[model samples]
Target: MTTTRLPLFPLNTVLFPGLVLPLNVFEPRYRALMADLLELPEDGPRPFGVVAIRDGHEVAPSAVGLPETGKPPELAAGSGFARDDPRRSFHEVGCVADASTIRERPDEEGYEVLATGTTRFRLVSVTAEGPYLTAEVEPLEEVAGEGAGALASGVLRAFRSYQKVLAGANERSLAPGQDLPDDPSVVSYLVAAATMLYTPDKQRLLQAKDTATRLAEELRILRQETAVIGKLPSVPGAEFTVRPTSLN
Candidate 1:
């Protein structure tokens, strides 16, 4: 595999190939990252690696409290540098993303970025020598292993059941004429992204060895989730929650 260095953006969420990631870039370090990407040639893809934060907050605190002299305290809250060590702070597996649209905010304070996940990569090493994080990564290949197509068919049926359960529990109607893709790899990724699984489960799906393995896992997950949902009184409305990152 060819290894290359790419800028890293660690988030609290796991990204999968072909998923859309919209980021509100306001931090100075990340704003610099956007500026650097904008400087790249438009003809070339502006790619970066996005690894899930394994242990802490994605947005680090810039300061905690004022010192006795009324001066801003140094980064005391784990600081982004001290806490965000690549080897310890993030999952080794991640997805490479291509920035499709970048628009500067009218206030000129930040940027709104729309990026799409393109491929998977394994983080080899990381450094904070620069303003933002950068990593050496080896791209992971997507392979359709033996019996992928057959597994995909079963996964599709299981996914439909999963969706139905969610709709019933949430009192929402399913979209009419909805159909899933036939390609096993596409199905694997699509289901992985759509399912409301926790970050670790999503990471596990992203790290599956091949399409067949991913589909098999999805089949089991969908059935399990569907059964669990069926027993619940009612699925609560979605709301953001501060979940601790898991490294299992």
Candidate 2:
């Protein structure tokens, strides 16, 4: 478990490794994050950590000057500047993402970044003394064991069945299957990214310490969702598009 200080991007949604996250770099702080990453050597990979915000605002809270229960006055009464320049509290686990494409926005406000999730990490500490969040992160890996292969196979089977339930693929329907990896770690993240599960559920899967646990959680979620849809037939989030960044 190697630790490094990397720029952090906190969002409202969870990101899984091996998934793609498209982001609009509109906010000032996040725009700063983009700039910082840009200054890194482009010869190799330039990446940042993205963690899900558990509370507070993605952008600064609207009523900024007011002091929270234990916060300092400069953040509240001391600063005449209205915007406290704060970041939200985020989940402990995050994914390191490498930018695949970057372009200037049409209006020229900020950049549009397409980041591909590379791996998961556990955020150790957040250094918010800068323009954007920077964090000390320890990289996380799948603790696969002898049983992980069996778990992966079961998860793959369950995921296919769940997809079929969602597609409503009747006897005549010749729909193809989603392309998923055979490796347990890759399979866990890929299916979690593809599924439209709730944010907490996704977070739970992300926080799972090993491939076996993550795969089991995915299977449980798949079965639960499939059962719900089977009875109700018109569940609200039956389908979802891959979400864009909440750059705020």
- Which candidate has the highest TM-score of all? 1
lDDT of each: 0.75, 0.69
Tell me the tens digit of each residue's lDDT in model 2 across 105-140: 686656788888898898887776777668899998
Candidate 2 lDDT score relative to the true structure: 0.69
Worst 10-residue lDDT window, candidate 1:
239-248
lDDT of 1 by residue, 89-160 (tens): 888899999998878878676678889999999989888777778899999999999999999999888877
TM-score attained by model 1: 0.84
Q: How many residue pairs clash in all the candidates, one count each?
A: 0, 0
Listed in order, each prediction's TM-score against the native is 0.84, 0.78
